[model samples]
Target: MRTLPPRIQNLTNKVSAVFVPLTVLLALSAFAWVLVIDNDLPAAIFRGLTVALIACPCALGLAAPLATWMTAHRLASRGIIIRSGDALENGGTVRHLYLDKTGTLTSGRFKIESVTTIDETLENPLALAAGLEQASTHPIGDAIRAAADEATTFDEIEPVPGLGVRGSLAGDTYALGRPDFPGQQPLPADTMTPNSRDKTHTIVLWRNEQPVALFGLVEEERPDTEAALNTLRRLGLNLHVLTGDASTQAAAFAQRYHLPVSTALMPDDKRQIIVDRRRETHKPIGFVGDGINDAPALSEADLGIAVHTGSDLAQASGDVILLTDGIAPLSDLFRAARETRRRIYTSLIWAFAYNAVGLTLACMGILSPAYAAIAMIGSSLIIIWNSTRGGSLWLRDEHQLTEEDPPTRSTNLTA
Candidate 1:
């Protein structure tokens, strides 16, 4: 099991430290009441000295809530309507992130990358092929339709379940599908390999009992993938891709930028994978998805990121939501969160520093309740000012990850 951080560290107790003076003042208040009623002059004098501390400003209490509100509101500006502040920010603290493949990271629109054919032109062969594919609602069909654009001339069309479709187009009889289809095509010595199928989609095209072409459907990667991923890396965050698609495709995606991928996983299977990882480490896990199928994994993750185009339910269940159609906006999400965190740290730092100074003055009986209130209000104002400064200029750009010069996590090393 590997251990990474920004681990489950809570600032609740430390932040609660501001209440110290208030508590002491409260106890003195009780003593003062007793002294006044009991008519004890000596005790009354002692109680009166600590009475000023009761004015300790409670403004620091507003810090966390205010920061949470501002950050969430900013996220909403980008169309990521947050259900709660907890989910928006929890992503920042997460050490591990899981992303769904289709419709999430990619545009979800599958297109024909290229038509592999030994013949010169693709017109006649593709005409009959598109006719059969028109009957299906699957991604493969969508790719064929997108490529063919204007409908091909079809005379007769019939489909054989689990096999291929028989059709005639462009005044020629044709059968377009796998060799498994009736009177389709002869099998080539080598068929679609596990590796080729992963990186690109395999849609067999048959014509007249002979193999005509193999159409490979390719989904375009969102330009922001490189940038968003680089930002995560800068933060030293570990990324994982979990999807129902084949590991071959997942591996191909990973290989592009040295990513780690998981494949052939169903909805629940995705959740189980996250569950398995959880057993090995205590670090928080963040899941990213843009499909209904991702709901299970989204729910299971410590932090779930449902993209804007994702299913409504998955979006509702997710911890964080990205507004941009691509991963580019997520860089902003991280930027804002990292700033919020940094500001929180700064707020805490000043909070402690302010407390130290206030306590010193308090012990000397020089600090009054008004002064404590002023200090509390002042410190909170500073934190409020800082959290609004969110993501940096570099984060707003999409190329932060893909540039020839990989962006750096810090000022030192390049990504």
Candidate 2:
């Protein structure tokens, strides 16, 4: 089960697909024998089997798939395909969403959001920082290179395993890394700390063997972040961001989105957070992630929502999957979930009502096998028809699925 594909997979589903029909076929044959035993009529055999043929819960079978397919088709018009339905169903009940910051919220590209010098060297920080960062392969380094407006040249470059890149510029040696030194020394509470900066760090710089300046750099929140957070808040969701990024960076994102922040999280650390939160509150938690790194957290969440625009591992692990990548698209999903739930409830009621009515007629000897067959078909058709409303539930798609391949499944299936 763990290794199975995300979509309908395995002996269970395949066997279940056929087993229902075969069982019905066999039951009809047995029923025909019973009718013979009672010497009622040969017509009952035809009616029961015909009912099995016509009313074999095909509508019930088609309900989810039809909804899925129609939803997928509807989403495709907006450049998305939903290859998973159970994931969506699970995500709807999410009262809390734990998001992976790096690729899920932030673009995973670092640019110097804003630069402030810890000392008094703000003027040439961009050029000098870019020169040092040009030697490293870290995401922050790449972001530094991209954000530097001024071009810089570097001399002898040395890569420190945990600290940062050390390079020379104009006969000066510099190290750029996290300000809270990596096991070397800890900064005091007021060691030229950056204020009003939350949730991220840029390249901490030491120029000429002394800490001349610190780069108050961090990841930027998407413009949509403000709106998404507001929507979640309005929906009474306590959104939290979990990340391996600096505590400061996570704080910044949390500030912008109004999400509570937990930072310095490893993959397992994230899983632990979800576990702790679930154990403490027992509220349904949803996770939104786009990286393979998010697989653990996504798996831990009750409603694992992986944007299809993300890694395949995320999609594979998530319970509720968003085919569209926009935060705005979540509103559409909210609507669809409510709609699907409503339809399921409605279908359940109809099933009960229809069964009750048909049973009454059967007990009264008024509903022959033919009438039971018709009633059964009617019962499921109502469910299928009701569920289709999920397709019309619309929001916007950010159209983020161009890079990732959609998981394959039977295209003929719906819902």
Candidate 3:
């Protein structure tokens, strides 16, 4: 509750402050009226007590928190753990959603899609690339190693973070990584490009100073991604891909998914995009990511969601965590938040209306103390019932994956 926006807390506090004193004045007026008209002290005291009790803002107090509690329970059952209630509240207002590419949209598993070599006479380029990447743990390196023959071997390997790997093979030095690596030349313009629709990423293999081949690797999108994106779009959210991948690949992926793309981003670059979007759009921005590289962007977003499978740093930095794979839970989260907000408004509206009518009748002496008590209890019950209704509306049929659905597992990168 303390984390709730100050405006909301202040509004509630102000209402409560005025309400208590107003109720007390109403009770005093009732007491005086009844005593003067009926000449009965006991009856006046009873009416005064009834007015005070009925005017208590129990329904008002329960409006937001009760709905929030119910929403938390429903979302927990659906594999989304909300770390902050305030975030959940704010999530309903999000108009833009920025998603990380790896481990979020894509499966984070890389596989060698195809390999192209500049020299037909050269032995398998994949084998040489694998030999150089054998000691590396990067997803791309692992993919190259997995595609190569098991007999491939290397000596004196040196790994460069975010670039590639280098090693001595058969008394010759070989490098396998990005084309822009130090002393590496770019592929010729006449070189055949991979299918743009496939959106494959390229890693260059170098034999000493000469670029020998290009390895095309692909990351599969999660099965639930399309449906989740469609749902968010239907909810009027502007979706954009914020990725550290090259602009060409990111643009391809975004085109395939029909979303805007921001590419070639550093960690700080991703944060800056979000900050700029927030300022320009003046709406809440939700970011979903699952890597140490995503921590800054996640923290910078208005609502940050991390997958349970993400790195510890990402999980800790996120406002919400998905216990399961895929983006289906994100849709559920937004639906639940929207529904919960609706319920709160409904409860508050009904509470205010009920109180207005009941207090007026009590002041006019048209409602007996006994009946006023019943009406007050009935109003609270109505609010509670309204709040509980349709709590599970967020769980869509598509969210329930059948046994036939492909299981999300780490790819055998070094197969």
Candidate 4:
């Protein structure tokens, strides 16, 4: 409530500052006229009081904040935590949406789709890679570790940012990461053919500067991803994917979903994409992401949405947090924002129109002071009633659809 734009409050304050004296002047004019015509001082005073009471601006004061509070409450019940009311206010106006690939659109959990060994003597390459990645916290590392034997161990594992993990075992250094890790020895040409499909990401394993194995890992799009994209498309948003994954992998995923993709982006690259898109489109951009790398882009977006399962940094940087696992709630969020905005405008118009009518009646001596007070109360009640009319209908519809169409996980192979 406190975070809502002060435009409405400031406008009302300024109007009230001018209104009070003008209202007093109108009331005094009425009083003087009644006193001269009817020769009744008490009746003239009553008319003056009626005019003052009718134009009190109580409904005007309550209009914007009350609508904001109602919408916030409604959104909270639907598993969407709005960190900034301004985000909610502008959510409906978002014309461009940039979604992250790994966690936001697809399941972050990756599984080994295939593994190829360059060295036949390198036995148990999966176990070796897992051992090197055991201490790392990246999703790919976790996936590798989870697929391998838990008992495997390594010595002094070090993570190379944007590359892979490296460590030593029995005086031999082993690394598990992208094919280009160490920026020296690339993966053998034979292993590159398997990634041509570009549906699955490849993780390379190296032993003492020699490329030994290539592990193909696959990530499945979330079951709700297609449906969510469809819904957003229907809402007229221009959707695009901005990912740190390889160009082939990101392009393949975007092709499957029929959305444009900007691939192989660094953290700063993602932020720059948002800046460039904002300038090109001249519209609000909403970015959805859930990783440490996404923090910068999330902060740069006009409206940033972080999933509940996202990294702590991502969640903190986002303007809104999806308490639920999927993106389905985003549809409801858009509807709620639009509806809330509509109700605010409705309340403001109704309040202003009601005051105008009531003031005219009171000034003309057609309404008594008591009746004017009742009318003022009635106008406030109407605004409150309008604000409370739509109660989570969109959320209920989304839940029903979810129940009818349960989410299923399916994997894709990427290079």
Off by over 4 Å in 2: 1-55, 79-85, 101-110, 113-139, 147-176, 187-191, 194-202, 205-213, 244-257, 281-284, 290-295, 306-326, 348-365, 368-377, 393-415
* lDDT string, candidate 2, 12-58, tens digits: 35634775776466546645765876666665665455444343334
Task: Give the clash count for each candidate.
Answer: 2, 23, 0, 6
Return the TM-score for each candidate structure. Answer: 0.65, 0.65, 0.75, 0.81
Clashing pairs in 1: 198-249, 227-401
Q: Candidate 1: which stretches are off by over 4 Å? A: 1-57, 79-81, 112-199, 203-216, 352-360, 368-373, 376-380, 386-415
lDDT rank, highest first?
4, 3, 1, 2
The residue pairs in collision within model 4 are 198-414, 198-415, 199-413, 199-414, 200-413, 200-414
Please give the distance, in angstroms, between residue 216's alpha carbon in candidate 1 and its true position after superposition.
5.1
Highest-scoring model, lDDT: 4
Model 4 ranges with Cα > 4 A deviation? 1-44, 119-128, 135-137, 150-176, 180-184, 206-212, 360-366, 392-415
Candidate 2, residue 133: the lDDT equals: 67
Which pairs of residues clash in candidate 3, taking residues 3 or more apart in a chain or in different chains? none
- Per-residue lDDT of 1-415 in model 1, one digit per residue for the tens? 0112222122444446646666576547645665768788665554455444433334344445555567767767876555544554475576667778777777787877777674555565455456677765444566787678466657778765334467775665666654345566554646554216656865566555566777667777777667667766665566777766655677777777566667666577788888877777776677888776688888898877888776687887787777767775666676666556555566656655666666655554465556655665676667667656544432455444444234433211111
Per-residue lDDT of candidate 4, residues 1-415 (tens digit):
2355635556766776777788889989999989999999999999999998888576777776677677778888879888875776678678778888888898888888888888999888988888887766567877887788653577678877557778888898888887667554787676788865777898888888889888888886688888888776666567788887887787778778887887777788888888987887698789999888889999999889998887898999998899987788888887777677777778888987888888899989899999988887888899888878766554555334433234332222111
lDDT of 2: 0.59
What RMSD does each model have against the real structure?
Answer: 8.7, 9.3, 7.8, 5.7
How far residue 56's Cα lies from its native spot in candidate 1, in Å, is 4.1
The 10-residue segment with the lowest total lDDT in model 3: 406-415
Query: Lowest summed lDDT over 10 consecutive residues: which window, candidate 1?
Result: 1-10
Residue range with the least summed lDDT across 10 consecutive positions in model 4: 406-415
Better of 1 and 4 by lDDT: 4
